[model samples]
Target: MSSKIQVLVQPGTIIIIQNNNYKVRLNMIYGKVRVLRNSHRAFKCIPWLLILFASTSTYAAFTDSLTVGNAKALGLGHAVTADPPGIDSIHFNPAGLTRLKGRQMHIKGVYGLFETNYDLGGYGEYQQGLIDELLEYQYPGSNGVIPPEAEAYFYDEALNSKSSVEGPTVMLPGGMIDIPFAGGVMGGASYSPPGSNMTFATNVYAPMMSGYNRAEDDPGRFFQERGAFTLLTYFSPSVGIEISDELQVGFALNFSYAGMGLELPAREPHLLLWQYGHPWFQDNFCNDDGTPTGTPDLNLCHIVSPYISYGDLRIEADQALVMSYNFGLLWSPEPWITFGLSYNSAVKNDLDGDWEFPIDPFFNQVLLDNMNGSLWPSFQALTGALGLPLPGVAETEAQGKGGKVNVQYELPQHASAGISIQITPKWKYNFDVKWTEWSVFSDIQINFDRDIAFLMLGSIADKLLYRGQNGIEPNGVRYQLNLQDVTYWGMGTEYQYNDKLAFRLGYENRPSAVPSETPNAFIPINDGILYSVGIAYEFESENTLDFSIGYMNSKSHYPPCSADLGNGCNPNNVAYGPYQGQDLRSEVSFLLFEVLYSRYF
Candidate 1:
């Protein structure tokens, strides 16, 4: 019997015993105790979780809705579909720009302020407790009696989570040069600042069961940390020509540069298992018998443990480049009526960057040892195959250091139409509608060069599974995002109180693109209604100064939560209060000031 056992163990057994004691201990202590408790708990609550996740994930919101050029439209509630003569007229109606009368140059600057508050409450906590009780039942308490405190800890860790307020300022600066030539020929170049903003906040929490621990109960804990920040910018230079007195055509070359920076503090919880906590816990918590846990505290300090590495994790993306083109047409057969159409081609982005990680040395060793001596080389090989830089170094240095190809992103196309009508000389009105084809923004593909790393990371197997789960195509591409065509309706009227001064009032209604099934932290979908009023002053010459102020109001409706869950703050669970499915309102007010100095050459 001894000889037979020795033969079965072999050299591999010895290595496994020596290098990975945690797995050995786990197997020895609870191997036969059933590891499916966590899975079971997940299954029990999936229906409700799916419902909430789906509803929130479906809609996409506009962090910044104001277009790049044209103060007139900006001031007129973005309702300048028909009112013309500013550099941004190309965005509304290129024909209006053609009627500029003479060669001119315009410069404008705008300061924007944004504020948002979220009110969320739900049943995530109660579900967490149920999962804990299940886990405790399957595993059995060490003392034969389950402690009520343990159950409370589980609930505390599962729900009662809050996020800090995040407000970022946006800057928009633009300039346009217009040239008027023979036969109504007007050519020009326009430059608008790329849309850019940053969001940063810190969260602190009390002790609770960690999603990483899978522990039925744990003492109070604390976690303090910061979130993510990203910046995006775009540049477009265009030229327009008039074919006849009533017909005008235009084309634009668009260029864009995007950069992202992510700095997550070191003291946050480590969702990975083995060294400290398990990765599964990051999204879930369970009991000894594998029951679902309720709302768990997500405060940063409460989640961290002494056994884990507390090193800051930073991911700074390299500058990504994309190019596209725009075409537009304007026709005015009658003096009082004008029509326009425009299309923007899809933009493809080839992103390459590194993810900087100062991971725990011990865990790194554990992972390396498991790889059978080929981790680093395999990682390098995969990076080369994907045209991506290593995950930490700058783009240039990453090319030299070598890494694996991780992911990719693509932009969508857009189409728009506008109409302007003159009702008497003093009163005029305009309308505009636009659509973006965002469904084409399908998948984010991650490629691996090394067979071992690829397999261990579940790149090949999990990729297939992920695709299937998200309705991805055969090429490992998933189009789970259900973004719909966007619609915008605007109406504005101008009252010319004599030729020197004019007052404008406009209103706009813009629908969100996000569907109702997959809401997440990134997209805040709210149908926005805008009210605007502006006054334009023209001096003796062709110079003008336009000042406009606008206000926007929006609201979102969510589901209900369970009674056991504290407040319905859990985005994953249902709401219990009378406010379930009721609207969560948000408000925004803006001020637009523009000075347009036009010089006829």
Candidate 2:
């Protein structure tokens, strides 16, 4: 009789199978199992194996803790209204620049350290054929479960994984030479890190199969790491005119440059058993007499060699240059009251660069020869699955890799309004509202030559549709984007005890650019309360120094994860996951230190 039997076992039950020539053993829990024998081999049925073995996890979303405004002045919650001092005043209220008592030159420098600790984990089933077919369609030139690409795309999607820990010690040493001419002229330059550092890790594991639960103390695994960095510098020149003692007007030209680099270390292990149709079994076949079987089944046996590769992809763009202009007005309506307004034009950046993706000479010769051509569409689709829009492509065009992709980024226009009042000789109050048109950042595009391999992936056509829907006209054969917008509200207070010492405090709340419904790990929507404190000391001379610190305790209440069916018969009765029930907390702290030196000319 055929040795086919289905049995339901309770959790923690050890089942033993025996045949005339063979024996097998397994631990079963809360499920039905089927055992079958054909010729001399046996197979067991474990339906939810993928769900049991898969890993589900979470990580912090990507959010910049560093605000673009002056880090020093920002530390005080921007409450420096009653007494506007130096060039740093442009950050708080450009109108405040009118309060400069004399022609002066000011220079300032800053340094900072940032860190984050992340703890995340989860379990989810793998849809065997779906992911494979999707990958094959997306990356046509790749073969048999491209583990590197798989892990890259998986983590990119699951983790929306960007770096949480960005250690940046930046210098904003700009010397503003202010002159009292028609109005006034001030020019200076500053340097800072534009975005969070990019650090990533990829892990892959083989699927479990019959007889060989492959369930040893530890299963096989592979890991890879990649790191990227960027530096940004800006130059500004401005002119202000004093219309009256109480009102002043000013204008400034803005220019900036950005540089970026990336490094990736790729590694993978060859598996002897995984290549063959039977993966979970031991490699060496032995006879009952404990002797090696000279004639091994070559069809069911193979060898995998350890392989490592490093790829350095570098791109430099002189086109990283950006330029804009700002206008400002300040008014002192009464002895105790002052108001300021500033408008900053958008800075447009069309970054053109030479890009080189150099493959490793040792282990990637095959990839080098075969992987030439356009892979952007596949890369875009992979990134899309992770909820991040690719750099220069629209959501629709993301599926097609063929087109002119240009690397571009834009800084939006901004409007600021602020008011300061001296309620008492020792106490001052301030309020400011700023609007940033971040929505103008719509999309980034990368232009590339049309390679047939890339064209076959439907990259160009998808992008064309996306452009049409967005009402974007293709320029120089490239696509466009429409990013989200942002608004900020701020309030601050200053208490003075003496001529040399003062205490400052402030608060700011900004809404998230991305809505909670489409929360992606790539860009986190951070809406939080910022608390700040700072101390300013003035020397007997014409110089001063300031120190400040701030903290942000943020929380996001995301909808629960999908329900687990095992605990209930119907969808409504399904067991809900832990992360699904409530809020996820994320915390960030900013320690800012700066020194400013001023001298009248």
Candidate 3:
């Protein structure tokens, strides 16, 4: 009997035990698990090993929909409902699989380029001038200008500082393939199986790849920075069956994985000082002591505020996985006309992962500091005199914790219909209408497995009526996107010049799901008009190459407003207060290119 065991560790770390008794223990960090053992029961630990490996895989950011697709469909702005004839049909209208006559294979790849610009000077003008003035006046000596030390303290003490304020370019890749077994026809004494003329297919596509990195000093940092990736890729396996010569149907199962991360300001600086009874801020004309004074000090009254300094609370979920499905049908009642419909089910995901956040060293040591080394000692002596322990002040340390954080997100369900008409022997036209149920994405909630370090900040607000000014109760940390349902319209034309050459062109109007009043810096998406063109060339028998490109441009602006949460833009009603009343404008565009090779044998 052989008793040698092999163990693989992450980061290329490995352990091998020839004949030693070892017990294994596993610990989790950054969504990865590490196994430590000292018992030789390797056979019994195999299942545990599998679980550990599975738990280590993590995913991030995902949205309601993807904008890129296969070259042919994308060339038609994805309006292939009634003209589906290849692997792309698996997603558009799988029933079109019956259009294939022989052995079929297709390999496709797509690349996407994205750009976003935000005119956030309105938000920055307030915070930047405040900070500069604070440094020059209170901590002076830079000749009436912001000192280099002040600038360095705000920008140099964080992650992704350089790109935190701007959106970055993103790349997306996608492909699909189908295999069919030419089973005989059904009925008429043949009595063939249900799917005798069926085809099987698989696809991998990145439908949503969008995010940004905002500079730490960006006034919007209190709202969001190091923006969440919201990136999602779908793996689908499907089957298409011809119910009859004139009608066909298909079904597909979709498995989606997402990688997500987000960072935002967690506490108010002014509130922190007030809660700790700091001397720099006098409350109700009283000094650090509770005694009321007739002459209230005004010199240092305006120095401390939520906008003075910054602290970050970041959340990350990797390899978050979920499942959904799609069904499609196509029918041709006449020789020159075809109709198609497809429905994609909603996907619900509960992201389980870890979170890391350290108190801001700059905020703690500078803005909230009492400006005296003995302040803590003095508070401790006073509390001890009253027979009570001193209250805890904000301590600076990275609170890295490993546990399941539930991020409940749902991809909206969609339904679309399309018609294709053969106007001439060489010319064909197509049109489509689609609807998305985006109301499911009304808001996003982040639930931690254990009490987060910043919960106390919100709890203090509720206890001290700090949130009363905003006219809301503390619900902890969350975001209110308040999105709306959207509809899309598309049109395309294809010209079959000859058996060896073909041309295609298309246009589509896709509206934004989020309202302008609730604009978000994380996703710079807007109502876009897509223009596309493509060509196909057949150089050999039943073999062809298809290439195409599409471009979309859109813009969105959020002016200052006052209204209820569900009706209009109201930042005070949301968790991140710093973004309130700040005018935000964005210009966004997307360019997609694809190439596909298909062969029939």
Q: Is candidate 1 or candidate 3 better by lDDT?
A: 3
In TM-score terms, candidate 3 sits at 0.66
| Candidate 2 residue runs with Cα over 4 Å from true position | 1-72, 79-85, 125-166, 169-234, 260-320, 358-406, 449-456, 460-483, 553-589
Error of 1 at 373 (Å): 15
Candidate 3, superposed: residue stretches over 4 Å from native? 1-68, 122-195, 214-235, 263-309, 319-321, 365-404, 459-480, 516-523, 560-583
- Candidate 3 per-residue lDDT over residues 1-601, each given as its tens digit: 2222222222211112111333222110101000000011111111111111111101121222233346788677677888884765656776766666444455555555655455543433433443455555546575546456544433322221222235432211111101121000100000112335876555444444444444556643443444333333334567788888789898877665655555545433222222233333345555455433554322233323343433445556644357778789989899899999988787676665655554456544442333233465576476457443333342223233334566666667888899999999899999999888776754445566554333423333333333323211112233334567778888899999998999999888877665555444434445678889999889868777888888877665555332121011222233232333345555656676777777653
Candidate 2 structure quality by residue, lDDT tens digits, 558-597: 3223212111111221121112211222333434443444
Give each model a TM-score.
Answer: 0.58, 0.55, 0.66
Looking at model 2, residue 474 earns an lDDT score of 20
Identify the candidate with maximal lDDT. 3
What do the candidate models score in CA lDDT, each in turn? Answer: 0.37, 0.37, 0.49
Ranking by lDDT: 3, 1, 2
Q: Which of the numbered candidates is closest to the native, going by highest TM-score?
A: 3
- Name the TM-score of candidate 2: 0.55
RMSD of 3: 13.8
